[model samples]
Target: MSSSMSVNPLWLFKVFPFLRWWPMVNGTATRADLLAGLTGAIIVLPQGVAFATIAGLPPEYGLYTAMVPAIIAALFGSSWHLVSGPTTAISIVVFGALSPFAEPGSAHYITLALTLTLLTGLFQFTMGIARLGTVVNFISHTVVIGFTAGAAILIASSQIKNFFGLSLPRGATFAQTMWAFFQQFDHINLHVMSVGLVTLLTGILVKRYTPRIPYMIAAMLVGSIYALILNQSLGDAVTGIRLLGALPSHLPPLSLPELDPHALSQIAPSALAVAMLGLTEAVSIARAVAVRAEQRIDGNQEFVGQGLSNMVGSFFSAYASSGSFNRSGLNYEAGARTPLAAVFASLFLGIILLLVAPLAAYLPIASMAAILFLVAYGLIDFHHIFAIIKASKRETAVLLVTFFSTLLVELEFAIYLGVLLSLIFYLMRTSRPNVISVVPDPRASHRPLVHAPDLPYCPQVQMLRIDGSLFFGAVNHVEQRLLELEQEHPQQKIIIINGRSINFLDIAGGEALVQEAKRRRRQGGDLYLYGIKPAVMEILQRGGFLEEIGPDHVFETRDEVIRHVFSVLDRDICMGCQQRIFHECKALPSPGGKPS
Candidate 1:
């Protein structure tokens, strides 16, 4: 049998499906993976419901998402510990896209959400197959930081409506919500506030004091009990604390994603937006965790993993899904050994959620809101933001611009703007390559470097050093500097450039270098370059510059070229020289001006 078949009969599918992860499992790995999976399953139960509600889906849909998508992504993905599920960013994006079509929580809206998921997954999968993952190179760290911080703020702002039982209008902007929340302060429901505050405190205390407890689970439990007490003390009608009621206690039922071409055409733009936004979040989080773990990321492969997860998830009662920062981090911290842990986390989460659906009827919606508030707060990297404000001016500007843009403009457009700004700044830096005029230091020196600015030149030769790449972007600046050097020192015919450090040279740059050499030669002075590295010399040779400049003119040593060039200078013209720049000039026969 072939090696491919010997490894596994499903190797053909493993190459593309990525779902072979669970089947490839063994004994020792399963032990570590189960431990990690159980830990994650314990944490995600409350978070799944909260995130689903945030996405404007029926609460059960959140648990539905945690099951299938997580399994698919983990099995197919490259990360050992990354857990894929419903996330805050994906929820906000879905709400923004669907609310325009039908009012949130309506049947029409749910259908549209599934349609959007299908389109997004299709696009991501296409991109993965086409190997276009390198496109993410445009997204800088500043853009991510700013966008995440803004998303964090949006999360906290959105939950205020539920947490305080405020009747603020739906679809209000972040700023408007803040204003409305404060304005409606007198109408706050005391019972709701008590449950929410207790839930928030419980989450904090469990995370800080117990540390190992599933704080989210504990907080929700405590909040549910507190709400039950109040309902008993004061009749449910008077206290007015709403419950999540009963959630469907069953496996995720398969459904068809809307595929009408007319429906696809109408929501095509939103699909594109969701695809970009969802893929960006997933890839970014994966890479961030991978960097800490020192693992290589194949962007195209990850695209396939996430795309398949969402595409399959849509049919299995999931809205759009991506990498969840909290769950992925917890998976890593919990000592997950392989992607099997993720698969196990998803499966066990579904089973546990189904068995415990009845208890959800007692869980107060305000408690979920409070838990999400804590989750949102954790997303902001305040220390990093402060450090950025105190450090680089450019990075700080990028951060603020991205942050404000995310809040003010459409989310997809904001990400594009931030990436565009980063590219522009990067181009600006590379466009002006350093063009420096360096002179040899005859003074006391431990190493060879031209540092003294006041040293006199040989009057017939000019030394130049280029400190950056000679790419097409730097062509205009480099050409201008070269022309200026010739114009300023017309009589200094012999030029020797120190090109030892430059490693890359394109055809344009090589042709330009040769053209400059000929320009100097036409003016009755030759061009010589000292310490030309082998790589650069190869480029010059390949580009036909060596033939034009002459092989003898290019020397490995500076002293050799200087010695040869000095002998060619007119002893009679140099005889009456006042400025004896070279030490060699002083050894020459008389009429010389200045010390050599």
Candidate 2:
């Protein structure tokens, strides 16, 4: 018996896959993950506040997202390196969807946000239960690469108002935001710009020279010190710089979503949109990290985890949360070995909030914006972007389309557009399977078969290879090419199909094969298949295609098939053919019983 068949099933572990990593948790790994967690927690401090501000909620609501949702997502998700919490995209979406219905930062707005989160979670969880994990497969790698790059630009653009201390209109598009900035350039506050530049420079230096320390902490400290010195020298009234003010020092409090039918109906479309965006962001980030970590991610399990996180988070004051590229990348780069780092980061954040909530009053908004600029810059994977450009033209098209759509269109529509384009390109490639003509190379020791287009063969035989699935979509293509072969080259009636690459065969493909066999038999030859896959063979047998073509027409070995066909060829036709393509052609009996 094969070892694969002898292996016992780990059903319990599959249901709770985290058990595989739990046993490896020693003190060394714990300490490493804790350090990574500490770094991640520090970074999220400014991000949580920034994202909440984007969502038009009080900063504490963003902190609440980091607490419970981060913990729950880490524990239940399949990726060890994925960290889920408040994200800029989700926050922007929430604000856009709910701001018109209720005033920003109002009690009514918070209620609607929570209700939307609940509905989004319910939709995501239901999708996961239905085993719709393959949905993300349509979102190609190129699409993700392009989307993240576009999102990075959006992040930087969104912070331009704060970074330069411009009072632009809220919720402006990228173009409008830039136009507003240029129009208000003369009104830029020199003092606020100085603070932001100092923070940005400090972060760049630290990250370049001494990367062991968290750059955000160093940048914020330097910016805060500069603000204090400026305030002392020029007077607080003169500097005109604003602070983030103090944050709530307590943990997330229990809350409830408004369950009114009117409220649910109003937010239903937005909820569906948010659910898809959140799941896509989370799964895309997970797969990205998993690639770096050389780990496997179960997208379905991640969906269940994210769904449960948001559902539970709605009651804990979190608006909407998803996988954060900044935090997850930091977690992996900081030596985190498992999901415990995310859990620790959530817990450490709660404790850190108690001590540092007062210090937030001294942190300037310009400094926060500068740190976010750094985060946004980091998200654009330039290496992969360049590689994709140089690799395939189709992938490059997907990347460019996805990138532009993300910047120019609605966020949900951008995602859908990328996935739709990817599927269309994939179908276009698969619908026309590669049908190549091949010949045996007499000089080669291994891989003896080589493609030889326009090469001459035996007068009575034609050898070809099918290098894709034989499904309904591809049946017509294969049949049309085979029909052209018999119509154009009447002498080459015997067709041998090398089916080594055929992985799938449907009813339509089976019927096409039977039809081709019958046509060949009427021409004093027949269709033969070699190296057919078990699945295709089973389909042919079930459809009675094998009986019609005759079981003897199938060959297990290429050599046997070629030799058998050579011996049965008409001796009169063999005498005129000078090209002996197959070795068996040499052994054909001459008209007088001498070797041909």
**Best candidate according to TM-score:** 2
Give lDDT tens digits, candidate 1, residues 182-281: 8999999988888899999999999999987889889999999999999999988987888988888898988777888988897777677677666777
CA RMSD, predictions in order: 4.2, 4.2
**Candidate 2 segments whose C-alpha is farther than 4 A from its true place:** 1-11, 14-16, 26-28, 92-104, 232-238, 260-295, 332-338, 445-447, 454-456, 483-490, 518-525, 547-552, 589-594
Residue pairs whose backbone atoms clash in candidate 1: 575-591, 577-593, 578-593, 578-594
Give the per-residue Cα lDDT of candidate 1 at 351: 81
Clashes of each: 4, 0
State the lDDT of candidate 2 residue by residue for 133-245, as single tens digits.
Answer: 77767668787778768877877888887888789987677788888999999988889889999999999999999987778889989999999899889987877788888
Error of 1 at 511 (Å): 6.3
Clash pairs of candidate 2? none
